[model samples]
Target: MRKILFHLSLILLFSSCISNKRITYLQNLSDSTAIGLEEFIPFAKVDYKYILQPFDIVQIDFASSDPTLVEGFSFQRPMQQGMVGGGGGQGSDPLYMNGYSIDESGMVEIPRIGKVEIGGLTEEAAKNLVQEKINAYFKDDVYVRLRIAGIRYTTLGEFNRVGVQVIYKNRATIFDALANSGETSLLGKKNKMFLIRQYGEGTKIHQINLNDRALLGSPFYFIQPNDILYIEPMKIRQFGSADNLTASLALFGGVFASVLLIVNLVTGGI
Candidate 1:
């Protein structure tokens, strides 16, 4: 009877799949840090080349020692926040609506400056180019700051935390995505992960293997806007979904009743 009970308990434990085994596997392998465990990549320190994509909302702010000359422009675009280096002004209320939306022509209309084509320019180049445009109004030494408000990425499957994360730095690494999503479970496809990237025309799906050290240097390692990080479930979720524990419990109860009946019959034998 004890042996039978022990076997039944094992089945129940198996039904709690996708929780235990995956976590245990991940905890054993993953090391949490901004730095990678393998060889260094050039893109690691150097700023990544990023193109402004569609559906992205961006802000551009211009400030000078003399605020009087900047009266004609809208101060609503990129209000100084979350720049690469610290030491800007405090966070103030947005001066206008949520940044400028890229039109179908891939252009943003700035007051007094007209339309600027920014879809193909990297963030750094865009800042310099924008500063050139705004410099005409105020002093030549004016400051131009650019920021994006709608940058985001999503993570799903076999992860501890799975959801959309808003990106501030305009760059996110593979490790950053997983960590932000509560660290993926060990049972998840750690060695093999899927990344979905969205473009103006459509989307592209790329497969990455984390077990390989080259992954640290891969171009896909840096996540872009509208990117999806999906970690596929292991064999456990499949087996767990097939579990019919309720029926098994009923069968065990019925077996216990039958055992009681057989014992009573033998005791009553003449």
Candidate 2:
């Protein structure tokens, strides 16, 4: 009976404890504490570029050699000098109000230009297409500038803060998104998180292992608009607050004492 209890305690301790390797991000190729620059020789970094998709909001700024055309083509209302929020946090409401959204047919309606197809095109391609359209109409120096409003993403499950988060940047990495949303909880699964991305074709889920170094080179390293990052809770979460050694030991002691007290009462009654 004593041996059985001893083995049960060992099993509980081992199962509930999380190792450092599982939580650490971007592990080296050789899995060494001290890695040299030589390890990066074979690592090929992949550059991730975001392609515009349907329902994506785009910020359009128009400038022209003729100043009147600028006011005519550009529809965005100027905000008060101190109205803009700080800390890389731009509210989605303002962007949605001022920006143009791509329709299901991959078209965005520009002021006086009507609807123009831009979905599935890169930022540069979309900008050039808009430029050509404006030039054809005005036949003058009409410059068109285009940018994605911001990177808006949602986080679910085992995160410190779950829900929609907006980062105001042309490009943002996975780490940047995580940081904006307060990162994951202690019980969050670092190795097996999922990134649900929306493409022009359809939505696809990609498994992301944050602990692996190869993630830095993966195309999914960069966060795209409307991305959903989900971190599953580790099995240790089922044990509640007894995830650490001290807590587990205290839990074991409490259970053992309760069992002994019950056994003593039963014998005494008998």
Candidate 3:
């Protein structure tokens, strides 16, 4: 009896608390953590926000740059391993992780633009601004194509899935990733999520509340390139609470052993 109880306690103690993290309840979303209509929040503080960092990839096309509209803003994209393997043969197709790195001088060289400044420009702003610059040199048809070929974001928190997401869509929202990455549980404290943003040499941290309707207007609602969001878990979910579980097992073991001993004595011949 003692040996059995000892083994049971050992097994329970080592087991992980947050188990079965996958959202198998996708069939029963109502019973799941994602609930209530979320009040949307804008990306934090609308400063001339631009997520492009060194080694970022961008694609620019021309609606009509003259079959040879002066090469249409020439640029370059470097390839790398998908991180699945930093060594080689990462994939049969060899996934192309694309992006141009910002040179220490804080400029990106174009075949024509020639070392243009883009460190602090947002996707939309960068697109519009780049178009104007292109039009100046070309008088014919000049529709511009701008995209963040290697932009991404990192979501860290109570979520079942946590990782850095590479994006091609020049635009996306925070809620977008949260939903796609397996939404957080009801126990996830919505009001205190953290948004870690990098601006030049400094990084800014913002506290946000998912539960508050005011978030609809907050600038942080729209996720930016290279932004990292961390959603913290509630305090009660802390470790050591499992210790109480072991104590309960110990109590049950005592009662069972006492009862068995008493039964043995009563049935024995005097």
RMSD value for candidate 2: 4.1
**Top-TM-score candidate index:** 2
lDDT, candidate 3, 105-212, per-residue tens: 556566676666665666676678768887787778678766665446777777655676654454666677677556665445566788898886678999976654
lDDT per residue, candidate 1, 1-270, as tens digits? 446655765675565434443343223234443444353556554344457775566788767777765566655355545442211222432422457777767788888889888776766777777887877655545678887663467777877756666545655677776666667765576666888886545678889776555566568767787688887866654433223434555565677668656765776683
Sequence-dependent TM-score of model 1: 0.60
* Candidate 1: clashing pairs of residues: 22-186, 22-187, 26-186, 59-78, 60-77, 60-78
Model 3 regions more than 4 Å off: 1-48, 51-53, 70-101, 128-142, 167-171, 185-187, 235-270
Clashes of each: 6, 0, 19
User: What is candidate 1's CA lDDT for residue 228?
Assistant: 86
Identify the runs in model 1 with alpha carbons over 4 angstroms from their true place.
Answer: 1-48, 75-97, 136-141, 185-187, 198-203, 211-214, 239-270
Residue pairs in candidate 2 whose N, alpha carbon or C atoms collide under 3 angstroms = none
Please list the C-alpha lDDT of all candidates, in the order they appear: 0.63, 0.78, 0.59
Best by the lDDT measure: 2
Question: Which should have the higher TM-score, number 1 or number 2?
Answer: 2
TM-score: model 2 vs. ground truth: 0.80
